[model samples]
Target: MLNDLPIRKIIHVDMDAFYASVAQLDNPELRGKAIAVGGGGARGVISAASYEARKFGVKSAMSGRLAIKLCPELIFVKTNFDRYNEISKKVRHIFHDYTDLVEPLSLDEAYLDVTANKKGNPSASLLAQEIRNRISTEVGLTASAGISINKFIAKVASDYNKPNGQKTVNPEEVLQFLEDLDIRKFYGVGKVTAEKMYQKGIFTGQDLKGKSLEYLEDHFGKSGSYYYHVVRGIHNSDVKPNRIRKSLAAERTFSENLSSEIFMLEKLDHITEEVVKRLKKSKVSGKTITLKIKYSDFTLQTRSKTLPYFVSEKSIILETAKDLLFQEKMSNSVRLLGISLSNLNTETSKIKVLEAKEKAVSVQLKFEF
Candidate 1:
């Protein structure tokens, strides 16, 4: 059955602890020590943690205070996005050397389709190694990779041998590999979903495969069909090179909670300005303006207004945000405020032309790499 599907060579490359690794690379003293990037203050959250810190149960998104409680000797470092972006570009340059079909998931990871590569190399496994080698030598960082027949398997396999390692799931190994996989390891299944799956006795891919499509749909809704097909190695989503941005937003977490609407206006004004600047930089506008509010109790609320036409000007965005802010009374003191624009004009005629050209490319069933 798998022999009938078109096979493409896909590789998922992920940097090892990117933010913390970068912090160590620039400062030699940070190497071999447990260091965390960001989350230095009383109200701070960790952005990333070094491997040494991981042993002490410290990780990204963990609160700084909690991280310190876990590892008292842990060091905190500031985030340098500019340096991270600079290094990301260098790594991307290495990817373009092999194929133009690179889709960046983030600064630290990406998906590369090397089915028909510039190198004319038949072995995708070797290509992955070459890319990882270049990143370590040229960029002074370590990376891990997963090479496989599709993006889904490739993504999961990348984490199999982490921290400067690689894994390849050949066409023949795809089925058994997926069957043995734990349900929690499935990309889209989060903690809540995993617990629900556990209740249904769907602990592994094989367990999930035992249920009928209707049963899965009845239990998991739209995601049910996805599980049914993926367990059988039937994921066909393409490695999209030009992923469109769905929305743009700017937000701030205030030092003190504001209890009055009058105090929120000034903060909203600054957020609106930042939103417009980003919209102009991306050369896109949107019809929907959403105001995100987080109360001191940590509950969240969102108020949105979709205009008749797209807007990018600060005056228009700020006015719309002001309207939403006062549309209803404050439930409690606000701790965070955000402004966002969606329904963007990014899907221009150029993207349509590219889609048309993409459809003309041919597919092959036999595995080449």
Candidate 2:
């Protein structure tokens, strides 16, 4: 039935090593060399690392000190948030030129539903290639795109190529593509789950397809159904223009700006705790959590991460924010702090089953600072 059903074309576009690659494009000297941006002090963590840096085993979230040890000549640069935002806008504008069915996952990645595109190319893969080219030619940054009949397949295809690459997966080829893939390649499967699948002898999609849905649900909980469809190339997920959010956030401006590091931490503790309680009350774990800090100089900086797992614990949420704050390095005095969570989904919602061990729905807690 899926083979005969009318297809909805989708394209997933992602900027490669987004933050670091943007840095390289802006600074010619940094090209082809190991470079990292953001909180680079003794206690700081690498926010973004260039492909060159990755080659030296440097990585984002690695301690700055250790990153330097890996690539002694690594160039550590302070972040230019304004610049990145500017380029993000430009890149988004380019996408809009082709289709309005665009959904931004972040400043760097987006899902474009081109079921009916402006250029009227009809072929999703062709449009994907054109968009990739437009990004490189217009924004001076390389991008990768995956085009397919649905959201899941397109996302998988996009990553098949590296910087400035495009991949297309149609209905017929979808089965083969998935059969060769490992269990961990599915959306929700992480390191721990992958190992569990391996022990269950589900080394590939074919192995996973052999198990019945009932068995998978019995073993993997609510996620069993999700695993079933993915391996069979039967994803029915939509490329939402904008997924509705489950949480709302508000911030108050202080009459007077405060500047004590000790005081800031104390305040953040309460704010983050309150946010966590709200999340639990909703019976949700936000995959995208944002931490906002404003300085006396009228400047603001925020960091966020989307985790593959969900959690509702106060201690875990607060600790993550605390890590980001220290990692970002407070540049000046503080005026305000705000925390918001989005990308929330119901914990017990049913989804496709990929493998026997791959169906547990861990509340996706986006690991953002």
Task: Return the TM-score for candidate 1, rounded to 2 decimals.
Answer: 0.92
Best by lDDT: 1
lDDT of 2 by residue, 1-369 (tens): 466544567789999988898888888989998898864765567889988888999988787889989999999987776688889989889888877667788789898866655676667777778888888898888999988777787887888887678888776777888888777777678888789889888888888989999978888888888888777767766555544556634343444566766776777778877787666655677666677887888698888877687666667667777777777667887777887777777543123222211311222211110
Off by over 4 Å in 2: 245-262, 265-338, 341-369
Q: Model 1, range 295-359, lDDT digits (tens) per residue? A: 99999999999999999999999999999999999999999899999999887345633542263
Query: What is candidate 2's CA lDDT for residue 264?
Result: 67
Q: Which stretches of candidate 1 lie over 4 Å from their true place?
A: 347-368
What local lDDT score does residue 319 receive in model 2, on the 0 to 100 scale? 74
